[model samples]
Target chain A: MSKVKIESEKCKGCYLCIEVCPKKCLEVSKEFNKKGYHPVEFVNDKECTGCGFCYQICPEVCIEVYK
Target chain B: MNKILSRPESLTLIQHSYCPGCGHGIIHRIIAECIDELGVREKTIGIAPVGCAVFAYDYFNFDVTEAAHGRPPAVATGIKRVLPDRVVFTYQGDGDLAAIGTNETVHAANRSENITVIFVNNAVYGMTGGQMAPTTIEKQKTATTPFGRDIKRDGYPLKVCELLAATGGAVYLERVAVNNIKNIMKTRKAIKKAFQNQIDNKGFSLVEVLSQCPVNWGMTPKESVKWMDDVFVKHFPLGVYKDI
Candidate 1:
């Protein structure tokens, strides 16, 4: 199984990854990051196919995928 | 198992200062990735423009120097001439490149300067409160053109790649967008080639990236992307305009 690690504070709440993701493993968080934006948070990794679609579309470069 | 995707080595840990969903961060990451892959992080010298990416030095871990508005091509030409073995590239926005630095860019391309130019064309002046830029599309609304750009008054957008293709010195010229996954992949390839051309002593390569400015464009991040894919690409078709 692959895993994704994200630096939540670095996210700018763009959601480019969440929109591009096929696995639906990412979702918007109610809590705000240090930047005061509701950055996307990673859900359970069980469904992560590691297609790398989210990582590629991420403008923040905050997501790191380990396969 | 190893890490499949992470931050590029050439990029610093400092978070991007661009607006949320801004395309500058994506372009920066890809440029850093290309530099890392080329193994020229130490030898690479970047000339930053006076646009939203002015703080590019803080984000890129490599040696980067700031240039006056639209003067990166001139500065880069001088640097590349002095350090022939070093890889030099300039990151300029449309306002800086096509408007303020038009003469500088044209002359550099005419001279076939051995440097790469990364031109980000979002069709609006992003840094200075979303004013109209030289590349602003016809009938596009901007701060200066609240009602929308009037072709009779403002004229049409400048076609940079096509204009540069007529120059004898430009060895390569390509235009790509970064609105979606497919376009982003093509953009990465085009950017990497622009850098590779410099490393190979190929002269005057420019990759025009059609990026999005959600805040300035008055659209959500997703809407901005949709605008880029649907409308922006129609005006500036993405493809290699020249290759030698």
Candidate 2:
């Protein structure tokens, strides 16, 4: 199984990852970071195919994929 | 446990100094990733340009040197000649490479200096506010050109890849963008290729990335990416303009 970790502090909430994820496994979190942008969350992790689209699209390089 | 992806070892733990959604962060990571993959950290020397990426030294974990505004190529040439075995590259913005440093860049390419140049073209000068740059497109509104760029007065947005390709000494020249998932991946491949060219002793490889500037463009991060795709990419078409 692949695990997706979002580094909230480094995330600028660009939502590029969420838009590119084919599985729709990511969503904007309700919480806010110090930068006031809503960090994305990994939802339904089991559905992740680990295609790494989110990791590739993230401008801030805030996502890490672990298996 | 297997790690599919993580921060590239060539990058430091320091948070980037760029504003939110800036392309500099993305480009920095791509360069760092290339360095890590090539296992050239020890011998890699990155020359930071004078514009927005001036702080590139702080981010890249490997050896970094600051060069005068638009003078990275000249500096990089000196370093590469002195330390021929080292993998040398320069990170420069449009204003630095295309504007003030044009002469240096042209001559370096003509000489076929064994160095990689990562040219980030956001059309506007990011560090000093959104001013008109040599790469700024026609009729594009900027701080200096409020009403939009006048072609007759300001001249056309420079096609750097095309210009450099004319220099027979340049072995590789590509224009890539980071506006989407596919393009981002292509951009990474391009970066890696440019670096590999240096390791192979190829001369004068330059990758012009059509990056976005959200804060200076006065748009949100998402909007900026879209603008880069729709407007910016039109002026600077993506692909390898030359390969030898």
Candidate 3:
């Protein structure tokens, strides 16, 4: 299974990845960073197909998928 | 491989939306080639601004995000912050960066955000029907400045590199043109440096390319290059403004 990691400090809360994920494995975490923004989180890594759609759509380049 | 030419896998085969002989095509090819050479096509993320090159998303093989007018910097900043491991850059035009999004560009650089900005300055606005742009030279005629751009009224042309370099956040800044083979080579080098700066985690690199918009400039493609060499270069001298 592929895994996705988010560098919490860099998340701008664009949430573009959340909108494009076909697996719906990502969401904005309730936790806020130093920038006072809710970063993205992988809700279900097992559901991730790793199609890289979320990676492609993310403007912040925050998501990395390891297959 | 010739870095100046386009790679089949890196670029879409469709005809570009830019005007005949417009520099955007050349700029696009150079950028795509760089991405291909770096083997970052899959890992690179590009932000396209709203301008003549708005369809830039269609040209590159890598993943792309369409940013609101003048917002590519902010979008790229967000992306770079989140995905520091990935290479992120923005392709913007004068009207998008220097005019409406000037604040965003300035602050992004001021913050030394780890992102690359490819700023295309063609003087007049290309997509919006040739209005006077922030980089349009004084006494130049455009749709909005039919009589000629009066410096006193419209203000002076914005020298982006000079302005951005003054900020401590910027790590690399260069101004190059594509009017000739020599300058085109220089532009490619500058662009490569800008991207490498980001890869090295250098903050806020920008390459202001003096491009041509023949249709908007009301000149033939050939004449536009001549105009750029004769006129535009006079106002925007070509050279590196900063590198660290």
**Best of the candidates, DockQ:** 1
Worst 10 residues of 2 chain B by lDDT: B17-26
Interface C-alpha RMSD after superposing true interface residues, each candidate, one decimal: 1.0, 1.7, 15.9
Predictions in order: lDDT: 0.92, 0.89, 0.82
State the DockQ, from 0 to 1, for candidate 2: 0.66
Please give the TM-score that candidate 1 achieves against the real structure.
0.98
* Top-lDDT candidate index: 1
Chain A TM-score of model 3 comes to 0.92
Ranking by DockQ: 1, 2, 3
Predicted complex 2: CAPRI docking category: medium
lDDT of 3 at B40: 77
Which segments of model 3 are wrong by more than 4 Å? A1-67, B1-8
lDDT per residue for candidate 1 within B1-244, as digits (tens), equals 7899999999999888899999998899899999999899999999999989999999999999999999999999899989999999999999999999999999999999999999999999998999999888888889999999898998889999999999999999999988899998999999999988888887899999999999999999999999987888999988999988
For candidate 2, write residues A1-67 as lDDT tens digits.
7768999988887787887889999999999999898999998778888888888777677889887
Q: Residue pairs in steric clash, candidate 3?
A: A10-B81, A10-B82, A60-B79, A61-B83, A62-B82, A62-B83
Report, to 2 decimal places, the DockQ of model 1. 0.83
Pairs of colliding residues, candidate 1:
none
What would the per-residue lDDT of candidate 1 be over residues A20-55, giving only the tens digit for each residue?
A: 988888999999988798988889688898888888
lDDT tens string, model 3, B112-223?
Answer: 9999999999998999899999999989999999999998888999999999989999999999987665677788799888988888887889999998877888886667
Alpha-carbon shift of residue B28 in model 1 (angstroms): 0.4
Cα-based RMSD of candidate 2: 1.3
